[model samples]
Structures are given as structure tokens and as C-alpha cells.
Target: MLTELWNQGVRNLVEGRIVLGPGLNVFVGGNGSGKTSLLESCHVLGLGRSFRTHRLARVACSGRTEFAVAGEVQDPHHGRSRVAVEWAGQRRSRLNGQWIDGHWEIVRRLPLVAVHAGSFELLTGPPEERRRLLDWGAFYVDSGFAGEWQTWRRAHEQRNAALREQDGKLAARFETVAAAAGTRLTGMRERFTQRLAGFLCDASTAGLREGLPAQIEVSFRPGWPEAESLLEAYARSRPSDLERGFGQSGPQKADLDIRVAGRPIREASRGEQKRVLNALVVSQGLVQVASGPQGLTPLLLLDDAVAEMDETGLGGIMEAVVSLGWQCLATTVDRGWAQRTAGARPDARMFHVKQGLVTSLD
Candidate 1:
């Protein structure tokens, strides 16, 4: 679903152009070359966020007005949608040749899955990381879910601050909104996990650890005592909450507990966590395309995520990827993997990237 990418002054990329095909697209590059930056550019152009440490404004050339990425997509091919993300100085962007109100709208078109070293955080980091894992799945399945998510987050913040400030009256009123929003967010999380777990069960799927007997499951639990209404819980926890300067209840404190084989991923072997991460990303992308907006499946972006896999692991992952007919952009340091993957599929396209330049190897 990515027509082409014309990146101008973004991160390591001084100015690089890439024209993509429908199947697997690989970017092969060495260390500081911009391999990851290209993938991050895809994400920023499509999602409005940078994957690396660079600031959004810095994504453009060091001192330029801003960086711009222009490309096309499926469904009513509207020529090229260009996004010029400016530093705080300029402060604006355009989509589909027309000026847009908010930058997020520009990001909807950029649905990318970038797995790098940080993926370890999925299992080793705080619960927020895991919560986000589930939410990405939810966002793909439910269109209105994002708006609900935003509302819930805002309400949660208001309620938490109120409770922290010891304003019982304000916290109580805010609790009403928070409670309603939490329930909705909780339900969405549940729905996404359910769909994801079911998809992994598909025999044609790839990347999951075979014979891992147990399945991937996610559950939501609030931080404090289980109460039917949040207002009641907040009232009960107020004394201690104010003592701690943070709300002890609601989605702010919610946790997404994920278990594979009846054992937590945090406790699982390092390899197991990697396999689980792969499985989750692959399965979610497949389902999103089958049932995302216009049923347009997402284009998978693996920024050097695969080179870490051994031969067998890579085989299983690629087999599933090919079987599902998903469009992908895989980055790697190994030229052999690039050769093999692109060689096997006639539609696959490969690019050689070094420093900041990109050249199609196909």
C-alpha cells in the first residue's frame, strides 16, 4: 500500500528517494547509514512520530524549514500526499496537497510496525508498554476507538490531578466522566486482544513459536480495589491518593497483563519474548488489513527486526508473511537475507542503503 516515498532533509537522510512496489520491500544498509532512519521516516510520514532519538523538527535537514515526505496509497489514488513537518518555528503540515488542521490526520495514512532493540521493553518495561501493544490492535479494528481513547485519557488526567490536589468535590465530578471513559477503553482493549488471540490460531499464520501450547492472552485490571463505579473507588482511596500525589484508581493505573504458556513474558526466556513480539506484530498487521479502514491492511515495517533471527526463525516468519499477502518493508544488515527474500518473490523489491543514500537493488 505505499506508492512511493520522497524524503527530503530528514535525520540522516539529506535527500533520498524510494519508489516502492506491492510486495516485500527491503532496505539494506550498514550501521550509521540511515537504514533505521528510512523506516522512521516511513513512520513519521505515515504516523507523525519519530522512531529514533531525533526531534521531529530535526527530522528535516539540520537547518532547513522542515522535512517533507510525499507518497501515494491504495483507494482512489489521490496523486501524492505530502507532509511537511516543521520545527516549532514553522509549525504546520499539509496532506494530499491541501493544508490540514492537525498533524495527526496526516499520520493516519502512515501505519507502520517498527520493531527494533527497544522491543524488549514490551516484556521488560512498565505496564504502559504492554497496554500500548493491545491498543494498537484496538485502533485497527475499531474506527471510533481513537476518539474514545483520547476522551478517556483526558478525563483520566483531570480526575487524577483533582484527586492528587485533594479536591474531593472536583475529583468526584470528574470521576463520572473518567468512569464512563475507562469502561469504554477497557472494552476496546478486551475486544482487540480477543481478535488477536484468535488470529494467531490460524494455521496459515507465521512467527509464533510452534508447540508453545499456550496462546497469547491479554487482560485488563485497574490499579486499586475493584469497584463497580470509579467514583466510589476514588472516594475510598482519596486519603492515601492525596498522600501519594497521584490517583490510585482508574485507567491511569490500569495494567494489561499478558501471559504466554501460563507464564508471564517477563519471566519467559529472552528468545521467547522476541518470538512473541514477532507473532504479535505479524498477526495484528494481518488482521488490520483484513478489517482496517476500507479493509486496507497495514504495510509492515521491520527495521532490522529480522536480521536478529536465525535461519529457522527467519524462515518461519517469512513463510507466514508471504502466505498472508501482506505488503512489507524489511530492513536488515545482512545482504544475504535481502538477496534471498527478494530473489524468492518476483514482486519483492530490494534497496541498498548506506550513509543516507538509497538505491533500488531490484
Candidate 2:
């Protein structure tokens, strides 16, 4: 659980400190009061990225050259530790008051899952989003996944460079390395997806919305022909690869195809998409807890959860979070809604945000 969060020079927030509860914490404020920025800070600190945007520079407050977020986290196995991330000309992270080489170190200490208004993109957006979701789960469950993924990424980059240079020998050499690494990466992803499918199935059976079918199917496309080996696919596509100046077939192109009642979920209504995404994210947290060795419960950051979800949908998501024993931080604009959602829970905490100021109302 995250016990403390401090942010400086982040968006509209010049500086703020929040002490969070172990269960649900709600942030209520009007539009542009920096409610979402607070959630973004936590996402950056935990995942080393933002759910709203990919540009780190954009997160820095106006007229500020740098931004920083620090958290005091208590893990079941690792105990309490101080983790902080700073971004100026470059990004840097520290653990237990000592500087670390990479952001993954901070991420490993504090695992997080986020569902924002745009979370429906996981179902309707591009394949890269789904790939990221899959990889995040694989990274948490499989210790060796990071190294393997990095190796495959490096090899893929090298092969692309070789292709651009028209270096046949070099490209072939790197292709061999890429094929081997991609094969292993794909295998791990397949196994992880299988485990996640079970969780998704259970969530679907439980029903995310009323009158919805329970037949949600998740299929994995390995980015190559199923009948041919990666090596063979690479050889088969080498000419097109050279023309395209990049590797077009491998784990890089993998996608998670989701369908309901034999139709792509993307074609569903907006409300239905939101419900599916909520289930997908919550189920992801459940899968991680069940599969992780440290018994780590992921912290869920939900931005504008009240606005993005209907009452029944929001209630179901909250119920799942509580039942799974995961910590959640949700932002809303309505104080009544916040109170209604959180007031009954003994462990729940609420905060009011106005023009970047945060006041606790527990």
C-alpha cells in the first residue's frame, strides 16, 4: 500500500502531499482542479509512465524545468521503502533514498493498474495498447520476462537497422537472434494470456453490466503465421521487410483480439465498452495478485471513475477492488457521489481538491 505521496512542479500542482488509506481513497474536485494530475503523479511514480500521455515533458508544471513525485510504499514482503522519480532534461529514480539506474527498479517496488476515461482504448484502441497490457502482466508474473523482452527488442532494433542499411549478412544474423528471443517471449506471453483469460472469463460470468452476455473470448495473435516458425516467417517476409525498412512480423505485431457474442467488442456501445474495460483492468489486478509470488496487491488508479462509469458499473468495479483486497485511488467531481460511494466504508478516505490544493475529509 502507498502510505504517502508528494509531488512538486507537476502540472497545475506546484506541491502537494497526500496520505492514502489502504483501501479506497477518493479525490473530489471540479474541472481542472488538478485531480487527474494527482492521479497521474502516482501513475508516473509507480509505472514510470502516464496513462494520459506519453510525453514526460508535458507533465512538468508551466514555467518549471523539472517535476518530481515521491512515495512511501509498504509492501508485504519488501516492507516499507521510499521511492521517488524526477524528470528534468532526463528521468531519474531513487529507492530507499539511493539513486537507481532505471525506472523498472521503482516500478518493481510499487506495481499499479490504472483505468481512466480513455481506458476503453484497451478494447478499441490500437494493438500496442493491448500488447502493453499483456506485457505488464507477464513482467509481474515472470521474473525473467523483462530480460527476455529487452533482448528481443534490442535484436529487433538491430535487425531494423541492418535492413535500413541493406546489410544482408548483418540483417540475417540479427534476424536469427530476434527469432530465438521472439519465440521465447511469445511463449511467455501465451502462457500469461492463458492465465488472464481464466480471470476474464470469471469476471464476465459475474457480469460487468446487466443483460450482457457472458461469452467474452480473448484470442492471441502471435504476429506471425501460426503454421510457420518465426524464422520461416522472417525469411518469407524478408523482401517486404527490406522495402518497409523494419521488421513487420514478430512479437512486435502481436495483438490480443477480444470478441463478445461473435462480434468485435469495439463495435459495442460506448457504455458497454467502458464496462468491459473496467472488468479487464480489475481482472488484471486479480490475476497479478493470484500469480505474483510476493502476494503483492496492485494499487489501482481510476481517473474520473464516477463520470466514466454508470452507478451499477462503478459499484461493481469498487466491489471487485474491495473483494480482491486491492488499494484504489479514484477521482470524481461530485462530492455527493464520492461520499455516497465511500462514506459507508470504514477504511475509505476522501479529499477535496480546489485549484491544486488538497484537503482531507476522512
Candidate 3:
């Protein structure tokens, strides 16, 4: 859990710090008051990337060339650890004051599950978003998944190049490696999906929906025909891949087929969609913690996601998240709802943000 967060030159927030409570931390503010920026700062510190925009420059304060987000987290494995991310001409991250070349350590220590305005994209958006959901869970649970993903991506790139160059032998050599790594990636994805399905079907994790749908089935599509081996699929698609100038079938094309009552999620009403999304997000975190990675509890970031929800809806969601035993930081423009939420939980923490300034309301 994130115990302390401090950032400088991040978006509209010019140098702010907050000591976060372990349970539910609510930030109340009007739109554009930098409540979302605070959430984005936590995201950057945890994942080394922003959930808002792809470019780090966009997150920098106006006229500033750099931004930094640092925090102290109560890691299950490492006790208290310091993690920081800074972007000037390039991105740099530090763990406990020692600079690291990549963000892997930070991610391991502080995993994040974010639900923002664009979260609906998980249902309507392209397959990459869904694949990302699977990969995120797989990374935390399966220690070898990251290496296999990297190996497959590298070999796949090489194979695509060979196909473009019209070298059959070279293409075949890289195909062997790509297929091996891709198969392992698919296996890990399959295992993670099975575990997730069990969680989604459980009442404890998915009870927020209150029996919304009869059956919520989530299946994995391994980016190739289920019956065919990766090598066979690659051989069969070689002609098409060569003509298209890139490999067509692999984990890169994977997706999670989510359905409700044997119907696609897109057909569900807006309210139902939100409930399902919430269930999925909550289940994802539960599955991660249950996967047995010691000291690695995911931080939940809600960027006004619960806004406009009715009192019961908001209350149920809050109750569900608080039961997860994970720390959460949620923002909303509804001061009344924030107050009510904080009032109900003696351990809850509250903060107010205005024009990027944050004040603890505890």
C-alpha cells in the first residue's frame, strides 16, 4: 500500500505531497481542480506511465521540462520502500534512492489497478486493451511471464523481418523461437484467465452486481486457432504474413472474450456495463493478491469513476472495494458523497483539492 506520495511539476499540480491512509482515501474537488492529476501522479510513481496520456511531457507542468513523482509504500516483501519516477530529457526511476534503468522494480513493489473515465473502453475498445488486462494479471502472478513476453516479442519481430526479406530459412529459424515463447505466453494467459473466471463467478468478489446477469463467461483467445499448434499456425499464415509484411497470428493478437448471459458485453445497458466493469476490476485485484506474490498488493486508483452514481450505487461500490483489503485512492466532484463515504468508515481518509493544492480533511 502507498503510505506517502510527493510529486513536483506534474500537470497542474505544482509540488504537492500527501500521506495516504491504508484503506480508502477519498479526494473531493471540482473538475479541473487537479484531483485527477493526483491520481495520475500515483499511477506514474507505481507503473512509470500515466493512465491519462501516453507522453510524459503532457503530464509536466506548463513551461516545465521535467516532472517527478516519489512515494513510500508498505510492501509485503520489503516492508517500507521508496520508489520514484522522474522525466527530464528521458525517463529515470529510483528504488530506495538507487537509480534503476527500468521500472520493473517499482512495478513489482507497487502494482496498480486503475478505473477511470475511459475504463469503458475495456468493453468497446479494441482487443489490445483486453489483452493488457490479462497481461497485467499474468505479470504479477506468474514470475516467468515477463521474460516469455519479451522473448516472444523479440523473436516475433525478427521473424517478421525475415518474412519481409523473403528468407525462408531465416524466417523458419526465428519462427521456432517465436512459436516456443508464444506458446508459453499463451499457457500463462490461459491459467490466469481460468483463475479470473473462478473469481468472477464468486459472490464475495462479484456481489456488487447483485445478480445482474445469469452467466458472465470470460474466455481466452490465444491469437490463433485453438486446435492448431503455434508452429502450424505460423506455417499456414506465412504467405499472408509475407504479403502483409508482418506476422499475423501470435499473442499480440490475443483477446479476452467476455460475455453476459451468452451475449456480448456491448449489448448490455450502460449501467450493467459499469457494474460488470467494476466486478472485473475488483476481481482482477483479488486474483492478483490471491496469486501469492508476497508484499505485492495492488493500489486501486479511481479517477471520478464513481461520480454521478446514485447513493446506493456509490455505497455498494465503496463497500465492495473496501472489502478487498487493498488500499484505494478515489476522486470525485461530489462533496456530499465523499463526506458520506468518509463518515461511514472510521478508518477512511479524506482530502480536498483546489487548483492543484491538496489539503488533508482528516
Q: Rank candidates, TM-score, best first.
A: 2, 3, 1
Poorest 10 consecutive residues of model 2 by lDDT? 203-212
- Give every collision pair in model 3: 76-295, 77-295
How high is the CA lDDT of each candidate model? 0.70, 0.85, 0.85
lDDT of 3 by residue, 235-257 (tens): 99988887888888989999999
RMSD of 1: 2.8
All-Cα superposition RMSD per candidate: 2.8, 1.4, 1.6
TM, every model: 0.88, 0.97, 0.96
Clashes of each: 3, 0, 2
Tens digit of lDDT per residue, candidate 1, span 218-336?
55565556646666777787778767877777666666676787788788766667777777777777666655565455677787856556666667777766886777888888888
**Which of the two, 1 or 3, has more TM-score?**
3
- Runs with alpha carbons beyond 4 Å of true place in candidate 1: 54-66, 76-86, 89-93, 101-108, 211-214, 222-227, 293-295
RMSD of 3: 1.6
Q: Number of clashing pairs, model 3?
A: 2
